[model samples]
Target: MRLVIARCSVDYAGRLTAHLPSAPRLILIKADGSVSIHADDRAYKPLNWMSPPCTLKEGDGDVWTVVNKAGEKLIITMEEVLHDSSHELGVDPGLIKDGVEAHLQELLADRIETLGDGWTLIRREYPTAIGPVDILCRDADGGTVAVELKRRGEIDGVEQLTRYLELLNRDPHLAPVKGIFAAQEIKPQARVLATDRGIGCVVLDYDALRGIEDDKLRLF
Candidate 1:
């Protein structure tokens, strides 16, 4: 990871044109080749960013250019650099993840019945060509359900779940696979989109799920 705090101005040219006036900001360059400019506010959200699969080149006198395959270009001109540092974060162990979302997935998988009566999890991290589905389950009628879990459900989550359903349903055994978008909090727009596509939306309760799991463990 590379961090640079500098007084800079940024301009993005592509589908839309945007310019950030000269100001002091933080520039983050990640190992994945992604670059983002951030102000002190807005939490972790970047003011501007170029996602991975892009290239960055440094020019003379504090100027940098980043370009993507789509011909998008982000030009950054730095007036002065206040701080500059880089760190090598080695290969990460798989165990480190978003605690809440990971735990929610585990709890839901262990207690698949929470989804519906007689519903049982077939597997967690069910593999698909593009990516893994959070949970695969068999419903009461023995129909397959592909679930996508998220910390905050948004339109993109619904879209992702829809893509998984499209792929899973292609399999002979899992044909007609239903989709369920489960999240701690779901946006109204996302719920509307899911409903229109016939995808089920579930608002998960972390503490409630943990309590249910505890009760089951005690019984066993």
Candidate 2:
């Protein structure tokens, strides 16, 4: 599958965030309204790796398909995947989205506590009053953080986080310390922005959050 490029920015930290589609095309339906994902050559080539009606797995993910050799037809799809990475990674886009949210939750719970003991963390979905902040954290220290979730794609900068930062600055309870813009995938410009403004930003890859053993999901 061909990967689509999105615009992004970067910083000295090598952190990044791409300007995602207002609503990512994580899901794709064929002319028949059947579901499909955008997979790279790696994902597409093994369509027949299994039997006609078989279950295939990838990167701890699953791919399901059925073949009707009687009609020279094959039907391939994910078992329970969702999210937009279907186009790029060829996995269920929905699964990618869910993974992103899960990762965010895990990261927040495990790390937010490291910032301080008395700190209180919060979680918010995309598109808050300021914009889409996948995870928004506000601590007892009056610090706030904004996270943009990305499953996979072209890494870009956090333009939305900047807007969130502006909003955080307005909040009396969260204005003094600073805002943290976090993401699993980010662009170069985003890191630069955070550095220049003296704000904190972090970028994590899939491997980074794996095996993290936190059962509690932070409110943010």
Candidate 3:
């Protein structure tokens, strides 16, 4: 990973035009040839980025250009580079969910009908071009369904599920696949985003699903 802190301005030209005036910000370039600009806020989302399958060119006079296949361009013009450095972050060991999440996935896979009557489990960790989906199943109507489990669901989880659905739907066999974002507790924002994307949300009751009834949750 290459991290550079610089006082630079950026302009993105594509479906829309945006300009960020000169200011000190973090510039990140990854080994994958992806580059992103970040400010102090919005810790997760970058101000602008060019995802790989793109090309980056460093030009003299302190400027960097990133262009993608669609001709969209991100131009970074530097005024003063405060810091620039690079590091080799070796290949990452894929993410491991906590015990609760893992157990939830197992329980849900066993009780696939919890999501809907007659829902049948197709497979767990269903392989895809991008990554493995948590759980793949078929609804009562025989329609394909993709279930993504999260201990505490957030917007990023929804986005991940969205990507899986996009790829899953591309296969003729699963051409009309739907998605269910299941989590122990879902944030309001995440729920709204999922609904906007036409993805259903299920607030998981971990203990209940595991067949361990908790007295507090009982309404008697």
TM-score of each: 0.57, 0.41, 0.69
Ranking by lDDT: 3, 1, 2
Ordered by TM-score, highest first, the candidates read 3, 1, 2
Check candidate 3 and list the clashing pairs: none
Go through the candidates in order and give each one's C-alpha lDDT: 0.88, 0.43, 0.89
Global CA lDDT computed for model 1: 0.88
Residue 175 shift from truth in candidate 2, angstroms: 2.3
Best by TM-score: 3
lDDT of 3: 0.89
Candidate 3 per-residue C-alpha lDDT over 19-127 given as tens digits, one digit per residue, 9 for 90 to 100: 9999999999987567889999997888998765578898998888999767999999999989999899886654687888889999899888788888899999898
Determine the C-alpha RMSD for candidate 1 after optimal superposition of all C-alphas. 7.1
Alpha-carbon runs more than 4 Å astray in model 2 = 1-98, 105-111, 114-119, 139-142, 151-157, 214-220
> Residue 104's C-alpha lDDT in candidate 1?
95
Deviation (Å) of 141 in candidate 1: 19
Clashing pairs in 1: none
Q: TM-score for model 2? A: 0.41
